[model samples]
Target: MKNILRTAGVLAVASASVLTGVTAAQAAPSCSTARVCLYDDYWFTGTPRSFGWVTYNVGVDSNDKGSSLVIGPATDPASPYVYFYVDNNFAGNNVVFRAGNASNDLRGLYMTPTRNWDDEITSVWG
Candidate 1:
């Protein structure tokens, strides 16, 4: 009886642990922490590109091509955020996103007072 009880307790703990791990995995973004991930399509679908802490021009694989994005916590959590620019070299109109934020699409994001961000991102600061 003792052996059976101990085994049941162990199995219960193991099952709980496994379920917790699955929930965490499902909640996590596809990209790593401290990086910004850009998606080619809405709802984080399509090709993905990740950027670390730096200001860079979006090039071949992702230039003026981002339709959605996920911003993860920065290396320093307190300063977690990224900026998307309308023109290269981080110039022109821009929009900001804080850590852990994801946009399904850019079609409704304001790049400037006069422009939308969808498919017009030329640079980024992460």
Candidate 2:
């Protein structure tokens, strides 16, 4: 009886470990095929601005400084059609925009070498 109980416990633990690994793997996002598209104009000013895109698999930190867009596998970071900004006018001086549950889209729209620009994000598409 004692041996049987120990074997059952080991099997239970092994099953749980396998299940947890599967869950974690499923939770991770794949950006291999994801792409983002961005428009060149802002809603308020309608001014044509040139913006670039970069792909980041790791999550964005709130304290980090720079103008960048965060995207997921379904949404390509290379093409950000929407313009989101983190400017100096906001309370925390940080802006985070979420598009879907599969991946979180972060836009550092207002980050400039000299200062931050508080502006509205025009549009976003995957």
Candidate 3:
């Protein structure tokens, strides 16, 4: 009886640990911490391009292809804002996203009244 009780307790603890891990995994974002991740599809469904505290043009392949983005903590504490630019080298129209925020869809985001951000992002900086 004593051995059985001990085994049951151990199993219960193990089960609880597994449940906790699963919950954490589901809640965590697909992107890593302290980096911005831009997705090609709405709702962050597509493979993301991650960026640190540098300027990236995203090249032609990723240019004008961003539809959503996830913002993480800044690489440096001083700069906690992320910028998405319509032109390379951080030029042209831009949008800002703060730390710990995310834009699941970019269709509704407009850099200007006439220009939507859905597929106009060509570069990123944070």
Candidate 4:
């Protein structure tokens, strides 16, 4: 009887853990509805250069706000490398960049309002 009780307890704990994981996963935001804009070979002029604008509706929930910018490789022929930005903030360098190869040229953008921004950013980058 004691062995059966122990096994039942273990099963209950395992089930609880699995359910918790599934619930957390379900709560996570998805980028399926994310709006993406792409541009090619553009030059920078000044601070806050407009890459593009995103205007969401009342019902749409955005995980973050930013655009992905691509720049040509230094020597490789891979067309361009990807950079990210969030709220106009650069992801990799933590410094803003221009459209081309400016000092702060942003390869991409990603901005999240939640306290879990760091985790979300890390996940996105990875």
Which candidate should be chosen as best, given lDDT against the real structure? 3
| Regions of model 2 farther than 4 Å from truth | 1-44, 55-92, 99-126
Candidate 4 TM-score to native: 0.20
lDDT per residue for candidate 1 within 15-117, as digits (tens), equals: 8768875433233365677777888887677788887746567687788888888887667876777887888788888788888888877888875567778
**Candidate 4: stretches off by over 4 Å:** 22-126
Give TM-scores for every candidate, taking all chains together and pairing residue i with residue i.
Answer: 0.70, 0.20, 0.71, 0.20
For candidate 4, write residues 1-126 as lDDT tens digits.
999999998888778769875433223121112212222222222212122212221111222322222222223233223233333233332222222332212233233232322212111110
Clashing pairs in 3: none
**What is the Cα-based lDDT of residue 56 in candidate 4?**
22
Q: lDDT tens string, model 3, 1-126?
A: 999999998888778768875433223365566777778887676767877645567776777888888888766778788888899889998888888888877999988888799988877777
Query: Given candidate 1, what's the lDDT at residue 20?
Result: 74
> Against the unseen true structure, what C-alpha lDDT does each candidate score?
0.76, 0.34, 0.77, 0.29
Model 3's TM-score against the true structure:
0.71
lDDT of 1 at 48: 85
Give residue 69's error in model 3 in angstroms: 0.4
Kindly report the root-mean-square deviation of model 1 from the true structure over all alpha carbons. Answer: 6.6
